[model samples]
Target chain A: MENKTENNKMTDEERLELAAKLDKELDEFINSLPKKKYEDGWPEDRWEEEMEKHPFFMTKTPEPGAELHPLYEGLQKLKYDPEENEPEDLATSYKEDGNFNFKYKNYRLAILSYTEGIKAKCGNPDIEATLYNNRSAAHYFLGDYRSSLKDCEFALKMKPTHEKALSRAAQCCYECKKFDLAVEYCDKVLDIQKTHKSIIDLRRKCIQSLKLKERNDRKKNQEEKKKMSEEETFFEEILRCGVTIEGGLGGLSLEKLEPCFPQLAAHRVHFDENKHLVWPVVFLYPEYKIMDYIQEFNETQTFEEQLLQVFECSPEWDREKKYSPDSLNIYFENPKKKLGTVKLCDTLGMVLALKDYVVKGGTPSFILLVRNSPAENRFLENY
Target chain B: MDWKPRHEERSGTLPQPSQETVKNLKELLKFLQLGARLDLKALALESLLAMTGSEDGIKSVLCVEEILVSLVGLLEDNSEPIAKDSAACLINLSADIHGPTYLLNLSKNYCPPLQSSPDTIVKECLKHIFNKESNIADECCMILSNLSRDEHSVGLMFDLLKETQYGFDDIINIFTKVDYNTRGAKLNYLGPWLSNMTQDQRVREYILDPEKCVIQRLLPYTEYKESIVRRGGIIGTLRNCCFEVLSNQWLLSEEVDILPRLLLPLAGNEEFDDEDNDKLPLELQYLPEDKMREPDPDIRKMLIEAITQLCTEKQNRKYIRDKNAYVILRELHTWEKDAAVLTACENLVDILIRTEDEIGCDNLKEVDIPEDIAEKFQKLDV
Candidate 1:
C-alpha cells in the first residue's frame, strides 16, 4: 500500500492485481510454516484432551458436581502467598486505591477502600491516621458529617497532632451545626500552630454561629416559658374558681382538663351556676372572679349585708312570688342576726331555686351566702 | 293623534335633537304613562331606544324625568319587545359612567305597574336575559354587563348569577355560538361581568365546577379573536383561580395544560418554527402568528401571574420543566418591558431554576446564561 501511494497513484486495476498476488503469497507462507508435531501425532480430539490436562486448562474448567472453590465466586482472588505481603504494604496499596477513587469522585468506593485499609491494622499509626483522615473526607463529601466526625476522632486517637484531622473534624461539626464542638476542634488545631489562619477563621465562624444559636435558643426558651406560664395561669384560675365552663366538666384537676382545653390559655371566664351545674358547690366570691370592687370593700357595708342586698334584688323573688322575710330585713341592719323568720337554704338549694327561676323565663342574680365561723371570716378579711 | 317625532334628515350628521324634537319625545313619553296600550308603549320605548342611541340624545332624554321613569316602568311590560327595548335604552344609556348608576337609582325608585317592588325591575331585566328571545337576551346581557361595572351592581348581578344558575354554561354557550356579531356583543358584556363576579369568592365556587374542570372550558376563550374583553375575562378568572393551591395544580396539570395556553397570550409575533415544536400540544401547535400577544399589559401580567402561581407546586415545577417553560420565560424576560411582567418572569425563572437545583438537575448547559457573564467572571478572577 505504501509503494502504491508513493508511486504517483498507480492504476486501480494494477493495485487490485498486486493486492491479490500478495494475498496468495502470504497464504502460502502461513500454510507451509505451521505444521508441528504433537509428540504423538495426536488427532484433533486427542489434542483437546492433552490441552485439558495442562494446569491452565484444568483450573479454567470446573468439574461437574464438584464443590466450587471460594476464590472462583464473587470478588475473591487466589493468593499465591498471603504471608509474603506485610500489613503495612497491603494497607498502603488500599490507601492508594482509595486516593485514586477519591480523585475520581467515586466517594462511596473511596470510603469502602479506606475502611479496608483501616481494618488491615498495619500497626503504623501514621498510615492508620491517614486512612481515617481520608475516609473522613469521603464522608464529608457524601454529606455524612456525623460519620466524618467519628472518623476524624479515630484519626486523632491514632495521632493526636494530626492537623488535617483536627481541621476536618471542625468542618464536619460546623456542617452538622454542632458549633460548640466545631469551635473546640478548631481551638485544638489553633493551639498546635498559632499561625494557622484557616483554623483561626473557622474558630471565629464557629463562635459567631454559636452565639447566634444561643440567641435563638434563648428566644425559643422564653416563648416556651411564656406559653407554659399562660397555661398554668389558666389552670390555676379554673382550679381557684372550682366551676365547670364550656370545656366539659371543667371542675376536673389541671392534669385531667389540660388535654381538653389546650388552646384556651389564660382567658378570663365567668361562671353561671344555672348555666353549668356539674360542680357540687358554688362559691359567692371565687378568687378567679375579677373583683373590681376589692378596694371599695372596706368603705362599703359588711359581707353579710352585701349578700342580703343581692338576695333582695334577685329576680327569683318576682318569679316564685317568694318575698324576702321581714326578719331578713332586720338581719341586713343588725350585726348579730340569725335565720329566725326565714328558713336558711344550703348552697345547692339556692342554686336550684335560681335555675328554676331562669327556666321560668326570669333572669336572676345568684349570690351564695356562706356563714363562715369567726376564724374563717377573719382569715378571708386579710384578702 | 300623531305624537311621533318626524324622522329628520341631516345626511350623516348625528341627531342634535332640536327643542321641537325634545318636545315630541316628551309627548311620546306621556303616551307610555300608566294604563297605556302595550303596543303603543313598546313603540314609544323603541323610539326612545333609538333617540337615546347618541350621547347628546341620551343626555336630552336623561334630563326628562318622566321619560327615565317611564323607561324603567316599561321594563316590566308584559310585551317582550317593550321590556327589551326599555333594557336596550338603559344599556345604551349606561355606556357613560353615570348611566348605570342612573338606571340603578331609577330601578330603586320606580315601581313598575306590574311588579310591586322597584328592585324587581333589575331582576326582571336579568330574567329576560335567559329568555329564548335573542334580542331580549342580548339587550339584557348588555345592560347587566354595563351595570356590573359599578361594584355594587356587580355584587347584585353575581347574586343573580348564583340564584338563576345562569353561570359558566350559559356564558360559554353564548360565546361559542356560530354568530360572531352576537357572540361579540354578548362576550363584550359577559367578560367584564364574569371578571367582576370572580372577585367574590362565593361566586368563584359557582364558576368552578365540582370536578374543577370549568377552567378547561374557559381556557379556549382566552384565545378568542373577536373580543379582547372575553380574553380578559378568562385571564382574570384564571388569576383568581390561582389564589388556591388546588386550582393552581389543576391549571398546571396535563389535563388542563394551562402553561402553553397561558404562553399563547405572552408569545411574540414569531411563528413557532422550531424542529421540536411537534412536542407542543395540538392546541398550541402552529397557532396563527401573533394570535395571543395581548396589547394590554394588565392581561399579560395576569398571564404571568397564573404561570407563577402554578409553579408554586413541586409537581407543577416538574411539569413546567418538562414543557420547556424556562425557555419561553427566558425569552419573555428579555423581550418584556413592563416592570411587573418582567418581575413575574424573573420570579418564575428563579423558582424553576431553584426547583431544578433542589432535584439535582443542575445541568447548567440547559439554562441560557449569556456568554458575557462568564467573561465577566474571568475578568474578575484576573
Candidate 2:
C-alpha cells in the first residue's frame, strides 16, 4: 500500500480535523511521560518551573513485535470489504441499516449508511434510486437543501418517475430561493401526481413569493423608465442651452457613464420639480482634493452665488483661509484642451452658453482656485 | 570543513551586529519608547531600522524584549518621521523568518514582566491604517504584508488581525474602494497582505463562508485597474481560497458565480459565433474589439490555477464546460506568450475536452494526484 502521506490531497476541512487529532495525540503522548527539570536562565531559580525537554527518557520504545504500538504491517484495512459480499446483498443490508437509523432520528448515521449503499454499485436501478432518495431526505432534515437537491437530481436520473425524489427536489429548490426553478420542478411533480396536498401547499408558497418579487421588480422597472424619459428631456434642454456635447469620438470614456449615486448615471442632468434645468457639477479643489459635488445645480445660480455659500465657513482643510467667494476663480477645459477662466459673477446659464465649453457625461466639472495664490498658479501651469 | 557546493552557493548571509553595538543597544531603547524627545526618538528609531535591515541584527534586537516593546509603543508617536520609521523597523522585523513568534509573544517572557497596554502592536497598526490622515497608515499595512509572507507567521499574523477593531470585512471594504485614502496613501499593498493571511485555514473559512457575503465583494477586483500589486494580490487570494476543493461547486454556482469573473480577464477581442456567445456568461458574451486580456502573466496563471482547482469536482467541470469557458482558454492559448501560463491553460483544456467515458471518473478529485507531482504543479510560476 502507498504511504498515507503520498499521493493524497485532503480538503481544508479534512486537514483541520487531522490537525486537531494530531494535537490530541501529541498531548496524550506528552502527558503519559514523566517530567524532567531544566534551568531557563539568570538567577534561574527565583521561582521554579519544570521543563520536559525529551520524552525518550521515560517512554518505552516499541521494539519490532513487543510493545503497545506495532505500527501495523500489511495492507491498510478498509472498514467494510466490498469484495466479501455480493453488491445487491450488501446494498440491501446497508439500506436496512439506514432505514433503522433514520427511524430512530440518527440522520447523520443514516446518511453514511445510505452513502455506502449508493457506492455498492448494486446494478438494480430501484435499489440505487432508493439509496439516493433516502440520503436526500437525511440531508434535507439536516437543513442542507442544496445537497439534498443534488441527490434528488441523481435519483431522478436513475428513475425518472420517482415521485418522492421529484417532490423533494421541488422543496429543495424552494429552500434554495430559486422560485422560478421551484415552480418548474413543482410542475414536473404535478405531471406525475395530479394532486398531492403538501406539494400543493409548496406550490402556493412559491407562487406567492414569485408574485411579490414580480411586483417589486415591475415597480423598479417603472421608476427606471420615468428616469430615462426625464434624462431624454434634459438632453433636449442641453441643445436649447447651446452646450456642445462632443458625440461619438473623443467623448467621455465609458467610465463616466456608470452613475453611482441617484441610480441612473445617464440622468445626471434632469429637470427640477420647479421646471428649471438641474445639472450635476463637480467642484475640484486641486490642492486638498476635497471636492464639492452639487447634484442639483440649477441654471439660475451664478458661479459667485454657489462659491459664496460653499466657502462661507473656512473649510477645515484650508487652514490659511485663502479661498473665499470674491477671490475664487473658475476654470473649464475647452475642446482644444485649453484652460479658459469664467467670471465668478457669471450665471450658470452664461457659462453653459460659452462657445468653447462642452459638457461630458452630463456633468460639467470646474476647477476652483483662490485667484492669485501659489496654489492657483501651480494649478494653472499644468494646463 | 567539507567543501560543499550547495552550502557555498547558498551563501549570501546578512550582516551581523558588532559586539559593541549589541552591548550598547540599551541606550537607544530609552529614546525608542513612548515619551522620548522627538528628534532623539527619530534618531534611535533610525538606528533600530538599520539594525532590522539585516537578519543577524534582527536576531540580536529580538533578544531584548523591552526594545521590541518600545518599538511597538513608538509606532503611535505623533511625529510622522518617528512613527513612520518605527513602522519601517517593524516591517523589517516582521519580514524576518524568525521574527513573527517573538513579535506575537513579546513581553511574555520579560523578567520584570510587562506593563499592561490598551492595544497590541497590531491594534495600533490597524488604527493608523484606518485613520485617513495618518501618514504611516500604508507603512503599518506593509508590516502585515511582510509578516504574513512566512508560513510560520501567517497564523500569528491572522491572530493579530482578529485582535484589531478592523476585521477582514473592514479590511476588504477599504481595499476595494479606489481612492479611499485622500492623503495620497494607495494602500494597494493590502492585496498581497490579504493573500498571505489566507494561508491560515481559518481565514479561508471566514472568506469562503457563504453567509458572510465576503467572497463576492472580492470578485470584481480581479480586474481592478490602478495597481497591479493589488490586482495580483487579489488574484493570489482567490487562488488560495479555491484550495477548498470541497467548496468549488458552490463557488462556481450562481451562489458565488465566480467562473465569469475568472474568465473575463482571460478572454480578449476574439469573436465567437452566436451559439457560442449564448453559452457564455453575460460578462463574456459579445466581443468588444478594444478588450484586453489580463496583462500580468502571473495573474493569468493564478486565474487559470483557480479554475483548475474548481475543475476537480464533476459538477464544476460541467459548469465550466456548459458556460463555454473552453472558447476563452482556446483564444488564450493562441495569444499566451508565457510558457508557464500556456502549460496551465493546456492542462485545464486537457480536462475539459475529454468525454466522461474517456476520463472514466465521476469526480477528478477521486483520481488522486501524487504529493510529489502536486508540489511541482504548484511551484510553476509565470
Candidate 3:
C-alpha cells in the first residue's frame, strides 16, 4: 500500500511539471508572432512625408472629391489664380486669413492681412464692409481706437445698416472718448433691435460719461475765464499807476501818459530831437535853468566845480557842515523818467546843492522842479 | 441783567464731562444696533472710526462681542456716509495684529465667498469704490486691501476677479481714476494682492486673457511719476508674472513688445558713460535729448530682473540679441555704482552672453555696427 501511494504521488508531480512546460511553450509561440504595425506599416517620418503629398493638405491644387473636406475647401478658397479668379475672390481669401489671425489674437498680423484685402479692391460692398468691420476689431484690440473708428466709418460707408459694424463702431467711439458718436452708433443699432440689452446698456453708459465729461469741461472753462479776467485787472492797474521803461522816451504820448499822471495833461512838453532832452524846463530853487549847466556837466572837472558853486549859493549854506544823503528829498513831476536822484543830479547840476545840504544832516528839505511849466516858481514848498 | 452760566463765563475751552455724561461702550453699541436712526448710526460709526485710530482703542473696540459684526452689517447701509464711515472703522480695526483675522472670520460667516455671486456687503463696497465721490471710494479700497492680506481672503479676491460682470477690470478702472499719489498708496497693498493671486495657474491664465490684457494695462503705470512706490509695486507684480513660462513667451511676443517698455525705466541719463546709447530701444528713441533719466536704483534693479526672466526662452533670447540689448546691459553693468544694481546687471549680462554661446557664437566682443547693417549681417549668419 505504501509503494502504490508513492508511485501515485510521483505521477501527480510529473503531470504538474508537464502542464508548466506546456504553458511556457504556448507563451513563447505567442511572443514570436509579428507586432501590429502603426500608420499602415509606415514609420513616423515617412508618414509625415506621405501626409504632405495628400490631396487634403495646404497645397496649390487639391483632389477633385477633396473639395468636400473642410481643410481642402479652405485651401481651395484661398488659392488665388490671377488668370481664372476675380479680384473679389482674392480679396475674400485675404479677409478670411485676417479673420483667422484675429481669432488667434494676432492683431498686428490680422491688421496687415485686412489691409492687403482692402488693397485688392473687391467691388462687393457686403464683402468690403465685412472686411473693414473685422479690421476695426483688430485695431480696437491693439488700442488703436482712432484707427478702429476710421475703419468702422469705412465699413458704415459700404453698408449703412450693418448691425455688427455699427455695434463695433460704437465700442471704438466709446474707447476713443467720442461719446456723442458712440451714442449715435448705439442709436442706429437700437433702431434695428430695440430690445437689445447690451446696446441699451452701452447707450446708457455713453450718456452718463458724456454728462460727466461736459461737467468737467464747463468747470475748466469757468476757471480759465476767471484766470483771464484776473490777469486783465492786473494789467489795468499797472496802466493806471505805472509806466514801463522798455521803449525809451520816444514812444511816450499824452494819451498813454494821461492814465498815469493827470497833472501832465496840461503841460506842453517838447522833445529836442538831436539832444534827446525835454524842453521848457525850469530849476527854481537853484536860481538857474538846466540849459546853463548841461554842456559843462558833460565834462568831469567843470561839472564838479559847478556843483560846488551851486552848493555855496544855497539858502542856508555852511561850508563846515556835514550832511547825510538820507535826509535829502528830491521830487520830479514825472516818475516815469527812468532816472534816479543821483543820475538826474549827475546829468543836470541844478539839484547838486540840495544833495550836499541834505548829506550834511541838515533839516530835511524838498527840491521840487517841473518840466514844461510856465510858472516862474516851479519848486514846491517843503511843507 | 440776566445772570450767565458759570461755564459760559469761563474761557473758550469746554468744561470736562461729568461721569454720568461720559459716553460708554454700551451706549455706543446701542447707537449702532438696529432701529437706530441713520444719523445716530453714522455718528456712532464715525466715533468708532476715530477711536480705532489708536492701538489701545482698537484693542478696546475688538473686546466688544457683536460690535465688529454690526460694523460689517452696516457696510450695506443705503446712506453713503454711514457705509463710508463703517468701512473706515473696519479699515482702522484691521490695523491691529488680530484685526484682519477677526474681520476675515466675520466676512466668512456673514458674507458669501466671492467665487459664488457676491453678497450685498461685497457689492456695496465695490459700488463705493467706483462711486463718483473719491473719499468713499478711497475708504472702500483700503478696506478691501486690508482684507486681502489673509490667505483665505486672497482666495476670495481671486474669486471676485473671476466674476466677469464686475471683476478685476472694474477694480483696475477705479485704480486708474484715483489721484496719482493715492493710487500709488493703494497700489502698495493691491500689488501684493496681485502677486499673491497670480501664484495660482488659473489666475495667471485669467490675467493673460486678451480681453483683460492686464500686463499691457500695467506697463504704462511703470512710467508714472506720481509715486515710485506705485511703480515699484507694478514692477513687483510683473516680476511675479515672470514665474510662469507661458507668460514669459507672451510678454516677449510681437504684440506686446515688452522689451522696450521694461528697459525704458532703467535707461540712465546721458550723463552716464553709456557708449552704446545709440542702441537704445525703439520706444525710447523719441524721448527729448534733455529729458532726465530714472534716478532710482530700485526701479533699475526691477527692470533687470524682468529682462533676466524674459531671457529664459530661446525666442526671447534671439529677439534680445537682435535688439542689441547686450550693449546697453554691458554699459549699465560697468557704469552702475550700486552693489545690488551691479549684481543684477551682471546677472543679465551673463545670461545674454551665455545664450549667445549656446547658439554657437564664439567671440563676444563689443560690435558698433549700425542697426540696419547689423540686421543684414545677422540674416547672412542665419
Candidate 4:
C-alpha cells in the first residue's frame, strides 16, 4: 500500500477549468440517474426530497467518447458508471468510520460519516436504521433539535420498535418546546417497554410543563378579564360624568374602544372607596420644564379646590409668588391647535367635559402657567 | 391601495345578531354540549358553520358565550370529519373582533372538559399550530392568524408568547420553514398574522429588537416566490415596522440594509452605465436582462411606501440617495402601469431628487406641510 500521495502540478487556471468541468459532469451524472418509483423507493423525505436520493459521496462516472473525461459527453459514450464497491461493504466501512469519530467526540465528522453510510443504500434495514439513529445522536450533541428529530423520524420509519430512535425523538421534541409532541413520543416508547425509567422521567417532565402551561394560561385569563371589566367600569363612569370621549382628537380610531386607561403605563384611572372616579391628572408647567403628577384628583372636585390642594405647601418650583389658586390660568390644546383657556371656577369633570379636552395617551394632560408673567408669554408663544 | 387589510379578502360580513337569533343559537349549540353522538355533532357543526358565515349569525352564536367550549371540544373527536368541521366552524367565528374578544374575555368560563386538554382557546390554538401531526393544525394556524389581527386580542397573545418560551422566536422558526408542518401547510397566513400583530408597539419592538435577529431573517422572504400571500404579508409587516422612525438608521444601514430589498422589486432589467451602477447597492447593480418588477400592484405600492417611511429621517434619506435609488425608480416609472404605485413612487422620487440643502430641514416628519402657499415657494427649485 502506498502511504504517500503525489503532489499536484496543475496551474490555477487548470484547477479552475477542472472545477467547472467537474461541475458540468456532476450535473450530467445526476441528470442521467434513473427515476424513482415512490411506492417501492427508499425515503425521499429522509433525503430532503431530492430526486437523486442520498447524493452525498460517489465516484466520478467517466464521460462519453473522449479518452479523457470527455466533452459533448451526450455525444458518443456517456455511460453512467457508478462506484465498483458493493453497497454493503461501503456501508459497513462508513459505519465503522462514524463510530471511530463518535468515540473521539468529533460529532461533526461523525455526522458526515453517518450521512455517507445512510446514503450508501445498503439492502439491510437494521444497518440503515442504525446509521440514521447514530446521525441523530450527533445532531443532538450539536444542539440541532429539528435535524435530530428528522433523523429520528427516518430511523423510526426504518425500524418502528427501535428504542434509541423513539427516546431521542422524545428528548428532541422537548428541547424544541413541543411538549405535547414530546409526550406523544414518550407514550410510544412506553408502549414498547413499560419499565424504561429515563423515558418515564422525560414523560413526567413534559407532563409537568404542560400543567404549568395550563395554570399560567388560567391565571393570565383571569387577570385579563378582571382588567377588562375594571377598565369598563372606570371608562363608563367617566363617560357618565359628561367627559366626551375622543373630544375630536381622532387620536383614537374608534369611539367605543374601552378607554385604554392603562394603569402603570401612564396615569391610573380608578374608583375611590367613596365610589367617585379618581384620576391621576398630569399638569405641565412648560416654563420650568417640570410636571406635577397629581396622584389623585376626584372628578367631583373643582379646579379651584384642586389648585388650593396643589399649592398648599407653596411648592418647590414656585420661587416668584407664582402658581397660586388666584394667579393661575389653565389651558389645554384643542383639536385645531388653538388654546381653550378654562376658568378657575370649573370643576375637574367640567374641565374634562370641555369641548377642547382630549384624553391623550390614556391620561388627562393640562397646561398650567402664571397669570401675566414672562413665562406665560413664552408658553402662549409656543402654544 | 396604500394599506389593504386582509378583512376585504375574508369571508362573510360583520356580526349583528338579534334576540330571536341569539335564542336559536343558544339552543342549537347544545348539540356538542351533550357530547358523543356523531350524527347530532355533525348536524350541530353544519348549522353552526352556517351561522358563522354572517356577522349577525355569529353575534347570535356568541351570545351563548360558552360556544367556544362546544366547538373547540369537538376538535378532539375520534371522527376526523366531525373534528374538521369543528375546526372550520371555529375559524369562521375567530375571523373577526367580536368572536376573538369574547374568547379572550371569557375563555376560562368555557374550559375544556378533558383534564389534559389545553385550558383556553388561544393556548389550545398555539399548541396545535406547533404540533403538526394533528389533522386540525392548519385550521389552528388560521384561527391564530385571525385572532392576532385585533389590538385587543394581541395583548393576551403577546403576553402568552412572552411568558412562555413559544415567543416570536419560535413562531418565526415555524413560519420560515416550508416543511415545518407534516400536513403540507405552508403556513403562509403566519405572515399576515404576524404583520397584523405588529400593530402593538411591543410586538414591533420585539421583532425590531437589535439584540435579536428576528427581522433580519424575514428580509430574505421579500423575494419568496412560492406564495404571494406570504410575500405580501412580510412586505406589509416591514412597512408597518418602518413606521418606527427611531429604527430608520438601523434598517437602512448595512446590518439590515433594507433599502436594496425595497428598491430591488421596483428595479427591472434596464441597464445603467458603470458610473450609475457603482453607486447602487451591490444587489441592484447590473441586474440580469430577464429581471422583472414585482407583478402585484398592491405589493409594489407597499414596497414604495416602506421606502418612503424610511425617508422620514434625514440621515436615512441621505443614505438612500447615495445608494443611487433614483435610477431604479426612473426605470420603474416608465414601466409601471398601476396609478397608485406610480404616485407612491413619485412621492419617494420627489424627496430623493432634491438635495438636503434644498429640502431645508433635518427631518421630513417635522417639516409641517406648508400652509398651501409655502409649497409653491418650496417647489420653486423644481
Candidate 1, residues A161-277: lDDT per residue as tens digits? 899999999999999889989988886786677567787678767766765565455445545655777766665554343422323244433344321222222312323443322
Inter-residue clash pairs, candidate 2? none
Off by over 4 Å in 1: A1-383, B1-69, B73-85, B92-110, B113-122, B162-188, B268-298, B313-315, B332-382
Q: Give the clashing residue pairs of candidate 1, or none.
A: none
Off by over 4 Å in 4: A1-383, B1-20, B111-118, B160-165, B369-382
RMSD of each candidate? 32.7, 34.9, 29.4, 36.0
Task: Give lDDT: candidate 2, residue A104.
Answer: 84
Predicted candidate 2: what Cα RMSD to the true structure?
34.9
lDDT of 4: 0.76
Local accuracy of candidate 3 as per-residue lDDT tens digits, A1-383? 99989866757788999999999999999889887655565476687655665556535444445535455545555575544568798888889989988998989989988888888887899889988999998998899989988998999999999898899889888888899999989978976876677887787688668756764554455456557676455434332322232222344323332212222234322224433223122222332332211112221222234445444544343233322222233343333333224332343323323223211110111242333233223333322
Task: Count clashing residue pairs per candidate.
Answer: 0, 0, 6, 6
Q: Interface Cα RMSD for candidate 1?
A: 28.3
lDDT (10s digit) by residue, model 2, range A123-234:
9999999999999999999999999999999999999989999999999999998888887788678666656768767886886677556545544554565577765555
Residue-wise lDDT of candidate 2 within B108-185, one digit each (tens)? 433212334526667777887788787987888787687667555676677776766778878877876666777888
Please report, as a residue range, the 10-residue window in candidate 2 chain A with the lowest summed lDDT: A69-78
DockQ of 1: 0.00
lDDT of each: 0.60, 0.76, 0.59, 0.76
Q: Flag the better candidate by TM-score, 1 or 3.
A: 3
Question: Pairing residues by index, what is the TM-score of model 1?
Answer: 0.36
The residue-by-residue lDDT of candidate 3 on B269-304, one tens digit each, is 332222343354544433333444456887788778
